[model samples]
Target: METLSNLECFARAAATGSFSSAAKQLGLTPSAVSRNVAMLERNLAVRLFHRTTRKLTLTEAGERLADSIRSNLEGLQDAIAEASDQQQEPSGVLKVSMASVFGMDYVLPLLPGFLTAYPKIRIDWQLDNRHVDLVAEGYDAAIGRGSELTPGTISRTLARVRIVAVASPAYMKARRPPASPQDLAGLDLIDMRSTRTGRLVQWMLRDEHGNEAVSPVGERIIFDDPGGLCKAAALGLGAAFVATSHALPYLQRGELIQLLPDWSADGGPISIYYANRRYLPPKTRVFVDYVADAFRDQDLAGRF
Candidate 1:
């Protein structure tokens, strides 16, 4: 039991790269967690971590051991919790990741109700654009568009994100509105650079009639974030190709108008993603279900 505790501490520390973070999750002091890791290293006759004043990184041996024990450790913990009566209610720190705009616009609105219902389930939400390594990073789940189907992870799509061309109402009034996708080349277009690829996001426009045309990419105005792209368009900087969800609020406010409404592209699904494990933590399970239910009930998929 003592060895198992030490291993738990080591595993948490390895995942977070910080003794304090591991201790917070484990409900132990940082010193205690550090001591447990040190004890683990001694018992195994291997230095697990390369510790410095500024950072803590796993040694090669530590990385190998962490990978081997991750699933096993989770299974053991789940089994123990299942056999115990204390874990009936979902109560734990639920670490989640998502893009800032999506989380704030969609997921954050659902939080008040979710937190009120599951008062014991604390949230550790990370608003980031990068695709996180779910198991390795110890994240309970992530919400975003086009989440990669990484090994040991499963994604449940919430919406079929439709991409549309949009421009400020003033800009549209000044310029002859694009009569067709081909006319987009003549407009002062705002572009979104993909954060992952560091390249301009190419707009492949498709209509219900099965016709396809590439919307010309522009170098005049560029932004890495959808929010920035939409804002620039709203300011009449140029027309922008953006996800409907990203431009929905501006469109509703009449600040922006949809262009070539009949033509749009599949922007991929907005999904809730988690590790594919045999036994999921109750907190994670409930949060996933709650978000899915909210999307369905509100018809966000159809709206987007």
Candidate 2:
């Protein structure tokens, strides 16, 4: 057994309290993780964990050792990160999780510039609509749009997102544009099922005087995916309310028209969050900085 690998496996298992979970985090098989821990126990002549079919409990010795080594391991990782950051060139794989629309429309396009600046770094990007657990899933960082961030993660605001109401030109020609939030009651709205709070997303609007009001509109079509909803709106199925960033391209291409132009909703901050800020790997830290700089203008409406 590689002593260092065994030590890392043991520490991760002790911290998470499950061999399988630790194995998953470390990208190792459960059997390999178990063997490593067993080898460490044999070398120390003490059982580390009390095992059962349902769970695992650390022994007294194991608990004490874990506590002692955890800080040391963290310090070592910090030292490595610092050293790597100071190197002349950064080289590594950066694993990132981000929302599908934003990732495709913005982040992916900026990759060429980022790659040119740091040629040695490679990105492993995952785009999904759902929130991801960065640390538990071994992702270096995640970009999310919301004011609420997960606990114990370091986050930095990258941009301000704006939500807007939109519909295709044909749809608007058929139905008059909503003059006020109350006018939505008579219009057909496309609903995103994922945004349902208590069966429907409250159709929120801002009046000319800047006061906000909610009007639940009738749904002609419902979809879970933003792409699908955007497509349906482009086909003149119904009026769709979405982020300006997501709808801008269609609006610019004349595929969709912005509705209630005078009204707008301030979405929470768009931020890049990381699990371990203090000891982030060099690649992740660099990528985070690059992304923040790229979106610093916060002019998504102009880009599309």
User: Candidate 2: where is the Cα deviation over 4 Å?
Assistant: 1-7, 14-21, 24-29, 41-69, 195-200, 215-220, 297-304
What residue pairs are clashing in model 2? Answer: none
- Per-residue CA lDDT of model 2 for 82-178, tens digit only, reads 7766764767778888878889988898899899998999888998867776755667889877625555478888777677788899888967778
Q: How does model 1 score by TM-score?
A: 0.86
For lDDT, the strongest prediction is: 1
- Give the whole-model CA lDDT for all candidates, comma-separated: 0.88, 0.78
**lDDT by residue for model 1 (1-304), tens:** 4478998999889878999988877779999999999998988889999999999999999999999998888888878866763547888899999988888899999999999999999989998788887866668899988867877899898998899999998887878878899899899989988878898998778998999998888799998888998999999998999999989999999999999989999898899999787667789889999999999998877768
TM-score of each: 0.86, 0.83
